[model samples]
Each structure stands twice: as C-alpha cells, then as structure tokens.
Target: MDALHAWAWRPDGPAPAMADGPLSGFVLGVKDVIDVAGMPTRCGSPLTAPDPAAADAPAVARLRAAGAVIAGKTRCTEWALNDPAPTISPFDADRTPGGSSAGSAVAVATGGCTATLDTQTAGDVVRPAAYNGVVGLKPTAGWATTAGGRAVAPSIDTLGVLARHVRDAAAVAAAIADGPALFAPPGRAAAPRIGVLRDPFTDRVGDAVRACLARAVRAFSAAGADVHDVSTGVDLAAVHAAHRVITFAECASLHRRRYRDHAERYGPRARELIERGLGTPARDLQEAGAVRRDAAERLGSLLEGLDALLVPAVPEPAPPRATTGDSRLQIPWTLCGLPSLALPAGTAGPLPLGVQLVAARNAEPELIAAAAWCERVLGS
Candidate 1:
C-alpha cells in the first residue's frame, strides 16, 4: 500500500485505456467491494478468498465501456460497514478519511485517480468524499445496479461516484446509471429553488458544520437561487432507527453462512452488526420497512416545488481514525431513496466541510444541475 493506504490492489503495470469515449481520459478506481475482472474482490476482509473476479461488475463494465481506465481496487471498510479502513485523510493524517469508501475518496482527493466507483448504504460514499474534499454523488436507490458487490443493506445500497468535481462525478454516474438519458450534461441551473433543511437534521450538527451550511445557503442566495428553510415533517430520528433495523437485518441475512463458520475473522463493528441483525425479530424488520416507506413518501412530498434540499453532509468534520464520523445527516435521504450530492462547501479550519444537496427519487438530472450551479457558487 502507498503511504495513504488508498489502494488494496494495483496491476503489475498501468491498466490499459480505451481509445476514445465520453470518459476516455478518466482514470477510475474501483472500490474493493466491487468486482473488477482479473482482480480479487477482497472487500477489505480476510475471510474472502483472493480468487480474482472472472468478470467486471456491471457498473465497472459500464464505466470501462465509456472509456475510463481501471486504475486498481481501492480499500474499503471491511464488508462496507463501520470498521475503519487504513486510509487516512490527505489533509490531516490523524483524522479519518471516512468510510466505508475511504480509499475511493482519498484516491480522488490525492489525484491517485480522476474518479472512483463507490457505494452507499448509509453514508459510505458521501461522508468520505466530504472528509477528503471531493465530490460524492449518490444517485437515487436502484438507479444504479448493486448486483456484483457484496451487500450491506440490499434495499438501501446504492452505486455512486467520488471525483474531484461535480461534472466528473456526474459523468461517471451517467455512464453507469440505468437511465443514462436522465443525466444529460449537467447544465447550470437558472435561479434554482433550494430549501435549507432545519430542525431534526440541522439541530444535530456541530458549530463548524453549521457555519459551513450557513455559508452555503448564503452563497446560493447571493447567486440568485431562491433559498428558504424547510422541514421533512417526518421524524428523522425514527427513520434513522428504522434504517438501522433494516440494515442490520439485511446484512445479517447476507453473511449468515460465512459468519456462522468463521466468526472470528470478522472485525468488531461488522461482527456486532451481524450479531444484532441475527437477533432482530422478523416483525421488527417488517415494521422498519413500513417506517421506511412512510418516511420516503413524506420526504418526497417535501421536494415538491424545490429543486433540492441542502444540509450538512456530516454531523461534524472527520473525527479521529478510531471511527467513521456520524451518518445521521445522511441516513434520511438514503433511506428515502433520493438522489444526493456532497460538495466541498468550505473548510472547517484545516478540515474540509461539505454540504449535501438532495432531490426527489429519479431526479438525478435536476440534482446534478443544481449541484453544478452550487459548485460554481462555492468555488470548490
């Protein structure tokens, strides 16, 4: 591994690039959890054998076809859970780069790659990108397939991208998305209507993040965008609780066989999640599903008349490497299956701070356009 510990696997020589396409010159890093032909998909876990994948995952194939070079497999939190990866923030070595897509974010941050394939169950993609000062785009759930990757939370797992710019991330996402046409070149929005989320979400963030969000709101307003405060109406705390129940239950379902036979091989956090999931009652899982649906509906309603809802991407800047920062600010949108983008807003001292922009389900085009506009305003 390099000093930053970004890559888990690198080719003996540079990976070949395609002659030409939309992403022709882009160097892409695949998250270790995702398959890349001829490379082992270790998922940052010792339990998985080092047998090379026979084929590229759908998302990887799509990006390759669009002419992105496969640089290598980047590290991920073990099983894409809470366990921290070895990668550290490029800005501050002692601070976390976030997870489970830590390597993906770090790779993009340090120019190790132009873009990276990432996934989000809770805040894997966005959080890391925020900490590393890159753009993380989590499309609406199911917009991009999760077929070839290990599942953390089957229903909520989303394929996303981490890159240095909104356009780069948007381009990578468009190439792999189910509805490619939905991501037409991100045009600058014309006086976009944006909502600044308050109460449940904002109340939890620390001073630095609050300042970052405040600056973002002001920038958008100054840029001629119609900005106003808004609420999700749904109880976000309840939604977060439901998200855990579902994530744990589904994750346990996927790893039951392996966990039962080689329990000692798993990391503490991953092991705890699996154990809790195994103990959760089926009725509770069902109820959690219900809560998810209800919350999604309410949040979707909140998006009407608004191009996007803005909020802090993380509760605070990246913390010590002992753990990934909190994911509460990101869970509600992920649970609701809305498209969200994290952009570097400003710095919290030396640490990078980000603000998230959320749009209704299947509205990635609008989300990207709005984000592009905000990216210009923030000058990030």
Candidate 2:
C-alpha cells in the first residue's frame, strides 16, 4: 500500500516543474490543516467532516506558482492539537514522529518529500521537526499568508516550512517570504555569535533533549559560532496562560455553531477545549491579547543584542507513537510572534533531536541566513 506516496498532490492542469518556475524540482507536502483544492482533508481526526476545498489555499497557490510538485497532504494531530494521528514514524513505526504537523515533518525526514508546508498553532511545527530531525521554519505571524487554511487557534496559527537540510529550508523560505532575502553562503571565515538556552537544559527539563542540545551547541562553537547564554525576562507562566486563552477562544469561535450542534462528531480533546473556550469571557481574551503584545515586545528586547537565540525545539525526542511529544518549550516563542527556525543538528540516542534559532520580530531573513550559517558550522 504505497502509504507514503503523494495522494491528491498534483496542481490544476499538469504537474508543475520547478525549472519552469523557481521551485521546479522540489517536491512538497502540505499539512492537512490547509486547503488543497481536490483533497479530502481528514486532518487525522475522525471528527472532522470537512468539505472538499473549493479553491487552492492562497499559500498552496503560491507554491504552485513556484513550480513545486505538490505532494499529498501530510498527517497531523487530531484537530491540530493533542490527539495523535495514525501516521507512524518512518525510522521506527513504533515511535511517534511528533505532531500536529506530524506527517509533514516525518515525510521530509524520511525523504518521502523534499519539503513540506507545516502549520503551527503552538509546537506543531518546531516540536515535530525536532523529533523527526528536520528543519522547521515558523515565520512571524502574518508574514506567511493564511488565507484558505483551517483556523485552529487563529491568533497563533503560524505557517511553517519543513525540510531535511537548512539550505533547502532557506530556499523554500525565500520563495515564500515577503521578498528576496540576502543569502550569504554558509561556511563563513569568521564565527557567528550564538546564544545557548540553558534553563531548559539543566535540571529543569528533559535530560536527553538537554544533552543533545549541549552537544549541538558545542559542535556549532567548534565550527566557529560563538555560542553564549541569553535570557528573555518575560514571565513564562503568564505567556503560557495567554497562549491557552487565545488558542481556545479562537477555536471555539471558529466552529461554535457546528460544534455545539453536532457534538458527537468531534473528539474528546476538541470538544473539551471548545467547552473551556466557551467559558472564557471576552474580557479574558482581551487580556490575553494585551499580554501577548507585551510579551512580543519583551522578547524583541531580549533578542535585541543577539544574532539568534538557541533552544531545544521540543522537550525531548519522539515519545511513544501514541503520544505526541510535550510542547512546553515551544509555546512561549510562538506567543511572542518571532521568527524561529529548528535545525536537525543531531540525535538523542534513538529518537532525532533539533535546536531552535530565534530572531527578533520580522527577522526571518536573518533567521534563515543564520540558520544557513549554523548548518555549515554544524556540518550537517
């Protein structure tokens, strides 16, 4: 059963060739959260009764224009949240590949596709890519067009790019970015100043993840990147609460009418969240928004002096295939609306692991450039 082939992946008319366009030779997988004209987007949930997309999503259309061969929809966590998808890891079917963009990351990691379109409301992009050992790029909010994609947590839903190599990740980002970015080829004669996030790596977080991150930072420094320590002074608890409110409220509003009318069709997690969201008053949402804006400003200030902030993309590598990895590390960054790139630097024993490079607001070009720099510094 060619379980991994591109199903419902071809664009309108004939297959698009990148030679005819910018992404001519590249093959891409689109996460089911976004619309792709002819596909039946199940989104790995038994509950979603989604209709066929009437038109290509704006993002999908952009990729098609670039001459990319649209591979089939990648698997995702149920409703882009906690529920695990049926998609198994290519490296070890018994282990999870991560989620909600599980399929997208695994596809690229397994070489099922060259690149993929992943959407992250929280750790969906960064976490999965880290577990699968692939690069995932989450640009600043609104930087990548979101028209035609299903709304999970609208306020925080971020469009991300997943690829096997940093160069491929950068190229796809350039094609989808606001404009052409300044690309400095990797392997610079001088080292780059990089910051290492030690809070999560010490006695505070998962040991395997921290060990892998330490090794990765050492590799970068050895290759000429000045890895250091930097801190974002914002209250993480406040940021986390703010993230929850916005995500739940937006989700509740998106399918308010239907979710209430046909409760049986939805999963336990989705239904529970909707209930929690419905309970959240408008005032709370407003407060969440205010805090989010403030958090972004503080993060901007935290990252002001550094070229990039280094952190583990996920708490640990892929857990059991049944449970998607924990998302504690990724939520704050997404809440701040900054540019983040996850590098598939090395592994944590059996499962794959990655490091995140975060830039200031609207600093995607630098994020990618720095990512390219790190890619070379780490030597694959």
Candidate 3:
C-alpha cells in the first residue's frame, strides 16, 4: 500500500521486520520533529538544517520495540509552531488538515498507516485529528519521554498518538509509556459521568460545532452516561494568552540563536513568534506559569467526580487553507496538561467535527474508557 505523501522523509529499503509484540501488525508514522535513528529531525524548517538523528528518540524506540513498523517521517508546522504544512485534508482538498501534526492525522485518516506519533504543545494533535476526523490522544505531560523530539515549549509539549480508533490510539500510548495494554476493557460497572464545559471558550464555537457536540452529548446520555454542564471558572482568553507567552518564551529559549542568524529561512509565522518570544519579558513568562498552575488546579477540580469533560475539539469545521484553524477550544485544556482524547462526533457540512473527552492528569485509562463508550454510541 502507498503511504500518504505527507512524509518529509522515508526509508530507502523495506522497514525492519515487525518484531513480535502487541503492536506487531501496526504500521506507524513518526512526526518530523521526532528522531527516528537515521532519519533527520527536520522540524519542518529550512533554517534549522539538522543532521540525521544518531538514534531513535526514546518514544520511537519504545514503539519500535513493541513491533510497530516505522512508516516514515510525517510533515509538521515549522518548529511545531503556527506555520502550516503542505498537507491538504482528505475530506476536502480545498481546506487544511490542521498542523503541526497535520501529516500524522492525514496519514491515519487516509489509511496510510495504522497510527502515527504526534506532539502537542498547544493544539497540534487535537486540531489536526478533528479536521481529519480521527482519534488523537495527548497523554498527560511527561507520560511519554521527549528525549529526542525537537523542542517546542518544553514545559507543555507532549508526545501523543493519532489513529482511526480510540483503541488503536490507546494501544500505542500504552506501548510508548510501557504501561499495561489497557486499550479498552469490556464492561465497566456503570456508565461514565462526563462533564460538559459551558464556558466562554466553548461559547466561541460556531453553531455547526455546537450542534455536533450537542448530538454527541445526547448519544452519550442515551448510552447511560451521566452528562452534566460544568464550569472550571477559569477565564478562557487569559489561559490562551498565557499559553502564548509561555510557548513563545520557551520556544525562543530553544531557537533564539538560529532564529537570529537564519531569519530569512524561517516561515513568516515562525519568525513572528520567535520575535514575540525574544521581546517577551521574564516576568510575563513567570506570570503565565502561575496562570498555568491555577488553571490546572481549577480544571482538576472541575473533573473531581466526573469521568471526563466532553467539549468541542475545534471551534468550527476545517476552514480554508489560508490558516490552520483556531486553537481557542483546545488551548485551555492543553495548558492544564490534562489527558485529552479527540474523537469524531459527527459531520458539520462536508467536513467533520470532533469532541474531546478530557480527564485529570494521568487518567488516560478513564479517558479511553469514556471515549470508547462514546465511539460506540455515535456508531449506533
């Protein structure tokens, strides 16, 4: 089968034999920022000309050891920031399949590979998965090591998985974390209590997205889930602004020099962010960190008794290719560092809308369980 052309680099010969393990039959794609031994970790930039990685990144090695075939390096936004990749959405060629995890999402959506490794410092993973109508899970921060992936807001960046099924996403996550293969256990005692966040963030979503989310909630409720409208009381705009400051500051720290010397080589969006980072004060970043902590605590409190938070993954269906789509709906959750899983809820126009189920930190199993139930409900 022909793998999606989302690859930035591919192996010359046949991939190493799929070693015997839980992931033996799976073919996986690695995002460009992730090191895959002999492949170059390009980070989708012309400026940061890097050499081939000497060894696979820890996460990649873990999957390789688990018997997943290395498909190739997928495209990403420049430096995993605002820049867009060349990938067009399989559902609608005129629109973008969000980034910087665009290629990975496209790969899975088009059946190019079983799954792909993706990273999210902001909304990279979820937005792309939503645009492509696939499953994307961003595990709790630090669950998967970032040992060899190109750095992008180290404090918030998280390695995740993109697949067509929630179970496939969970399996890859478990393999990478070296945890139990809890893809989706059968028959939990009762239905999950899912919280639906009704805040300014979700309010910003268009009618189409809201309709889609409403349908998913109805499906969950019908399937015995106890769905409630909840609030974290955290200001959405403030969280998004703080995330910007933190992201820019950390990103600047990692690429300031290269950015200074190779300004022309960087994309316009990348250059704009690097400049913003360079100009940002230490006080701003520290303040943003405080906000992040408070937001995380507030979010945790909101999920206190609920199994997960059901919300719109993106504010609207995939927009025109001029931009990668908004991350407003996803930014707050990302900053909170909660485990979030995005799954296709329904269609909005010709494009698809996704609903995200978020649980407290390290509660991936709970997230998967609820997502599995919702997936079945939507299918029915």
Q: Which candidate has the top score in lDDT? A: 1
**TM-score of candidate 2 on Cα atoms, chains taken together:** 0.91
Residues 60-83 of candidate 1 have per-residue lDDT tens digits of: 999989999899999999999999
TM of each candidate vs. truth:
0.98, 0.91, 0.96
Candidate 2 regions with alpha-carbon error over 4 angstroms: 4-19, 46-51, 182-190, 200-203
lDDT of each: 0.90, 0.76, 0.85
| Residue 28 C-alpha lDDT in model 2 | 89
- The 10-residue segment of model 2 with minimum total lDDT is 1-10
| Model number with the top TM-score | 1
Better of 1 and 3 by lDDT: 1
Candidate 3: residue pairs that collide: none
Alpha-carbon deviation at 42 in model 1, angstroms: 0.2
Report how far residue 147 has shifted in candidate 3, in Å: 0.5
lDDT of 3 by residue, 194-288 (tens): 98888876777889988888888887888889988988788878999999999988898898888778889888898898899989998898999
